[model samples]
Target: DMTMVLRVIIRNRLSENLRHRFLLNEPVDVILMFGQIMQRNSFTLMCSSLRAHHCPDDVNNPVKEVCPQDTDSRDGFIFARDIPDRSTQSYRVQFRSLILEKKLGDALAIHDKIVSKDKRLIDRSAYNILIWGCGKYGYSRKAYELYTKMKESQLAPSNVTYTSLFNSFANSPYKSESLKLCEKVLRDVKKFDINLNYINYHAMIKAYGRCGDILMAFDLVDEMMSKKIPVNSETISFLLQGCLSQTESGFILAIMIWGKMKQYRIPRIIQHYNLLLRITKSCGVKEAASLHVFLMKNPTFFLPISLLDTESNASENTSKLLPITKKSRDDSAFSNYDSPEKRYNGLGGLDGLLAMMKKDKIKPDIKFFTNILELVPDCDTSENEILNAMSINKVQPDDVFLCMLMKKRCSYNNYEGAKEVLKLFNEYNVKLNVLVYGILATTCRTANDAKMYLESLDSNEIRLNVQILGCMLNNACRSLDYQYIIYLMKQYKIHKITPSKQCLKSLANAHKRGRQIELDIDNNVDVPKKLRQRIKRISYKHFVMSYRPWIKLVRNSEADPWEQFTVKYEDD
Candidate 1:
């Protein structure tokens, strides 16, 4: 019935050609309306069938043929023009895309258009997007530009906005520009009722420190403290770094910051302790010991008394143990507890740390161990004290700390101590990584011990890296060990380690000394294309000046030129 009625309507209404092309079924819109009116229990089925029958074919449909250019103005407006809601969403999408793409100019233009059209729609979310984008792309000017625009549009900046701006300027190449921005932001903090949070102050301090303006960083901290802004871990860390080069002033400032933190009961983070450790290490273990004793006596000034107190009763009885007046606790901690001689005798530097460890019963971590090791060079502590610390705690030194010790020993050419460290690693069952091998190799090279060099290579514990290879090549050339040169080339091939400029230079010199002229040519031939030209230039110079004259003398004698050249080179 459905097909019969539609077919009859189509045949009666138009010419045969038109009937074939024009759809004479109920109009699609009409079918939809009819389905709704009939409550076609199967609405989905009816709609699918209707769509299928009335679907436009490109060859026959007039609507499909009608392009945008052919549409009348009203029809165009109804079908193709953007609605306000759609336009808003599209603008947001495009703005985000531009911001992500780091197309700052495009983003700014779009942002401006959106604001101009509807100022009320701009929110913190939108502002954050722009601020973060600007910082990440290193576009400080655009970031400032956006800030000024946001303010002009009456969108109040939040603390986050200020933080982002501060961070952007802090990381920018123009250090003065960052400082100027920080000053301006700080000045405006109260006017805008913005809380200059720890992050903002930290960024400013770090920026100052990084630019080598330690005094400025100190002044900024003083300004913050004077303003009653709290000192935090970041603030203390920044001050500590600046103090490294200027020991006295830096230590004073660090102690002052620590005092402030303690007064406020801010828990000292690990970094804070590390900084204190470094200061003590620099001053010498004896001084560090005295400082430690002073800190322990004045626990309330450096650490929370609660951390030092083992039992709950100690905390409850804190007032009973000490005079317990707030002002006395603050002022009396750093005051002279005893005469200098008495204090130094009572608490030797490393002994002070040992006493603290015993009192607290807290095992020192790796950083703590390293700090002690660093202080060793400055301490009068005997080797027994050093060995005892390692033996008791079973603390294994990492490659970096071990390497530092190796370098110290090598400076004095103390090969015995260097050998002892390798023995210690073996005794402890510590697996030697590539770095450890490199350090050993370097030490051996510095001592010019070829036997040790070969021994290091024979060790299964260490793998060879580029640095090790370089050290080997350097030693081989300096000692004129031609056989070692052949061994290095074979090892390089087996390990697939590429030689660096220094390594190649040393190898070439070694080859010339060994009179392995053919091997030297082969090595040069295999050099990377870019480096080959440079090596050739250097090799040519050395050959003409050093080898050519020797060659001429040998040839002038009754000796065969090539054989004499080989003999003279080998003898050297």
Candidate 2:
């Protein structure tokens, strides 16, 4: 017992000494203090520094602030300690700090310095960190170069290293090159016997999606399933978005993927259902109804079988414990699953679906009702069901819910009903966000009362976004009211909001019409110098990317011959 106690005391002392050494000033100080006698301790201290020095590049850029003076004279600093490991550790910390700050140039310089000074000190992780930082900052080409260098160094890369490389190539500006890199990585993962994780599969799928290669994305999904790696919900979401953007077969593909998700027992929430609805919109009413019926009747296979069994046992126990009386019979029932025949009987329509939800005690929320409202078009019964669900569940109607209501009313040419939804904002004391105002702006344009809503917005002090501004300009162009367009220009100027090409094109169209009416906004055949300068600063890439979807939806909503007019404006 005494000998064992002595051994424990000695082990504790050694651990304490190692801990004390790691708690020094920095990696450099620890190495200098112990030298070669504590090589493992020194190496560990250096790694810990990497963890300690990590900060988000966007949050703070260490390159903006001057590095410490000791980092400059590496030879002199190392000569003071006469140890090569210390020198390498010093470089690692500096490189890590620069990369974390998003100072790519500075980090590259340090990399060159480390190679020239001593290649022995730099390891795989040092290269991986720099690659990750470069990828994150959109310098994917640089990350690839570093990846190649890492291979040449003969250091075997880990899963994290490959994940970073895959991510870098995915985010690369050149889509063709990114696709090539993705394929190469997929091959390498198998060749090297690296255990492929969900992250690796997700990055590959997303890369394919971004390149508009929806088929490749699905093929990768099949490969992922074959490997027995569970598909992530986020991965499915990306695939759905890619399908929506790229394929004629997207509707069928999305439904198939949804079914597959159920088969694989992948967890999904309302957000996933919303994506399904958005994708189904392109498929038409009949397809949407079929999807609704399928969802209502099908049991979610994602739920665990064991959990159902446990629930059944609990219910049986509770029923047995219940008092057996003639007047008050035991009513404890726990079986949640209905007969397959009964489930099929509930597939009549939207009302049937809602009744099934209520029968199953699935409390419907705002998103649930929004998706239902979208499916059942021009139905007062669907609207009443939404109101009843909200009232019973006490789910406060959000801006999205209100917008859907307004849109449905407008679709039925019930402009008065749409306007009443706007009034309900004040009645419900709901704060009007940008999206709500955008919905109202569209309603105003449809009602031919854009000017009234514009004035109402000013009185209400509702902040104006570009959507509201564009709506006013569009309405002005239709009315040949160039004065109203000028009023919108001044309103945006007051709000300090920049106009996009779409806004400018609308103004130009209005100018062509207003010449006969003696409207005075246009000064010449060419745009004014101030307006031209503002247009120069506008990014057409951002404008088109953000507003094209909105424009598509608006055009789809109502077919006006003027909708055929394509807005033309250049960006710098």
Top candidate when judged by TM-score against the true structure:
2
Residue 81 of model 2, lDDT score: 19
lDDT value, candidate 1, whole model: 0.53
> Which one is best on lDDT?
2
lDDT of 1 by residue, 229-257 (tens): 88776777876765554443344334445
Ten-residue stretch with the least lDDT total in model 2? 328-337
Where's the lowest-lDDT run of ten residues in candidate 1?
563-572
Q: For candidate 1, what is the total of clashing residue pairs?
A: 0
Q: Which portions of model 2 show Cα errors greater than 4 Å?
A: 1-157, 164-181, 184-193, 231-238, 261-271, 282-365, 371-382, 392-394, 403-419, 422-430, 443-463, 477-572
List where candidate 1 sits over 4 angstroms from the true fold: 1-157, 164-181, 184-193, 209-235, 245-248, 256-269, 280-348, 354-363, 378-384, 390-396, 424-431, 444-572
